[model samples]
Target: MAVRMLINGVAADQVPALDRGLAYGDGLFESIRLVDAVAPLWSRHMRRLVESCGRLRIPPPDTMQLWSEVLEVTRDMPHSVVRITVTRGIGERGYALPAAPQPMRVVAAFAPPQVADSAYAQGVRMRVCDIRLAEQPLLAGMKHLNRLEQVLARAEWSDPAIAEGVLCDSHGRVISATMANLFAVVDGMLLTPALDRCGVAGVARAEVLAACPQTQVGALTLDALLGASEVFLSSSVRGILPVRSLDKQDYPVGGTTRQLQQHWRDLGLRWSRADE
Candidate 1:
């Protein structure tokens, strides 16, 4: 399948040329995991979408209707990745908001990446990116359309062996990965960087926070991040992925990472070929 897509409830692959989303990157998006026509984390995606739309002053699409469209676009998929995007709609030149803008909604589904068994079994290699995240408290934690920072950071490397790139703020505080939230197991407590200043708050990260009793959120430095007994990255699509190495520093795939992986797997979420 050549990636099914829908634009404003219509079967299409293109959006308006003057769409505010295209022009100004004024939008919010969610990447959902669709299995057997059902999204395991649909609730979290919708909740985050609502919260993101509120943050951007854009109206949210109806959840029931959006669900229907998701099913329609991904009808034949056993396991797929669907992306839902909501933009502030078409606007003329200038950043000024239209008096009453009709939010543009785009829903699309595609085959997921062919994940290697070792990615979950042995774990993934990561690198620390030199591209530091700028502090923008207003845009922090929301999955907004603006992602030039991540694009640049991801461009810092091309080796497919490096599964992800760990990111830090301008002050050298560990924030997250290029596309996932990061967690470090220090001593015995679970520690994740607080996203109050920057970074995306991932759904899988939220689940871990709720599931782990000994969890703490704070501004973690790179030195403090690498001092952990174990490390892992979380994303709604990938679940929990154990970090085997950050550059040359190696971390063993420990029990805590596996426990969370099994937790999501028990929810019927597909991890990878390894999980099967």
Candidate 2:
């Protein structure tokens, strides 16, 4: 079936070319998992989108209307991936913001890849990417459309055996995976690199923190991760995935990782059953 997309509350046959999101990557997006026609992490996704828009100086869209559109689009699907993209609307051929910019909202629903669910249970293999993330504090931690870093990182490996790539900042500090936030279990505590300087603060990472308050959030060096007892990564779309290997080091997906995964699964089930 052809996926449907809602653009500013109107059904669209195709995305417009003038969209700044496509032209200059001037936008933010949220990739959410829908279960039983409900987005399991809708609130967290919305919160991050709101904050990103504010930071980028883009006007916020109607949240209630947005949610309604999301539900409307995914109503028929048993399980799907919902993508919400908000752009700076159309503009003239320049970087100058339009005097009265009418921001574009795109809500799309499609069948999610089966790999998303299986990745959490079976875990995934990773490689150390050659592409390094440039530190951009202004754009840090927002899922904005500028993804060249990840694209380059992902391009490093063509082997299907590799599931994801672990990225490091220019200074060689481990930032995250190509599409997820990373967490390493060390000394009996959860350790994830602080995204204050680089990388996206994933919704799944936030949920994990909420579930386990004692998990530490701070700067993490590659050496620290290499010496850790276990490692895992998180994303809103993929939930939690244990890292089976990184570079030459390998770690088993242990009890703590399984416990957190279970917690996330329970939360997803609860959210799916909640009143829409």
Candidate 3:
């Protein structure tokens, strides 16, 4: 490995031109946070990767081999982010699957995002995106390579003040942020948007639900979100981040959000202070 990246167990920076991931977006990816070169949620990520591969009809990579590759790429790095990408490999010019399929795996490591301490302490600002998510039950909840919806939603805002963008389904139900899962405390009960119809069911969201047993998953309206006493966004890389405001509606950084942040820290994941 070239200290940062590996392509199919080789030290390379590019994949074949006919790769299906680039040609048709036939792949899945996972972004894992590394603390002291260790991934605390490795098993959770691998479980999702295997399940998604089964759904996409692509052969899953061996978990042990992938972990070795992850270690090789992130060696000596105190804190970083590693992305694992698995694609259908090179294929012909059409949509048919290759008779003998060859899956491509790419593991790369880089410095973690520089999120300020205040983003976790004081909370971050968010905006409601105009782009609505289309419901697709078959493809829901997997971090597949095709992400044009999130691309358009994130493009709606370029202001440095906005930390994230909220995405809703066509029926006006809040689904998630452009890059994270949504959570709101409504009437003293923890609620998250149900992903049965659409939206990605993130690993961090699962962890939150596990730690906070009172959480309820169902349809969440934009009005309910604005009226909630607390709101937060969860991501594998960013961990748990409280939403201080959405558009003009403001929310306080409540106790539930603080408790979850401690839970994230206890798991050896740090988004705001990577050095510590």
Whole-model lDDT, model 3? 0.92
- What TM-score would candidate 3 get against the native? 0.97
| Residue-level lDDT tens digits of model 1 in 1-276 | 678999999999899999999999999999998778877778988999999898888988999999999999888788889999999999879999988999999999989767777888888999999999999999999999999999999999999999899999999999999999999988787899999999999877888888896789997889877888999988888888899999889999989999999998887887677566
Best by lDDT: 3
Alpha carbon lDDT of each predicted model: 0.90, 0.84, 0.92
Give a tens-digit lDDT track for model 2, residues 1-276: 668789898988577798788889999999998888766678999999999999999998988999899988888787778889999989988899888888999999887654644456556888888888888899988999988889888889998868999899888898899988898988888888888877999998898888878999887888888888889988777667788887678888888788877787677632222212
Between candidates 2 and 3, the one scoring higher on lDDT is 3
Collision count for each candidate, in order: 0, 0, 0
TM per model?
0.98, 0.93, 0.97
Between 2 and 3, whose TM-score is larger? 3
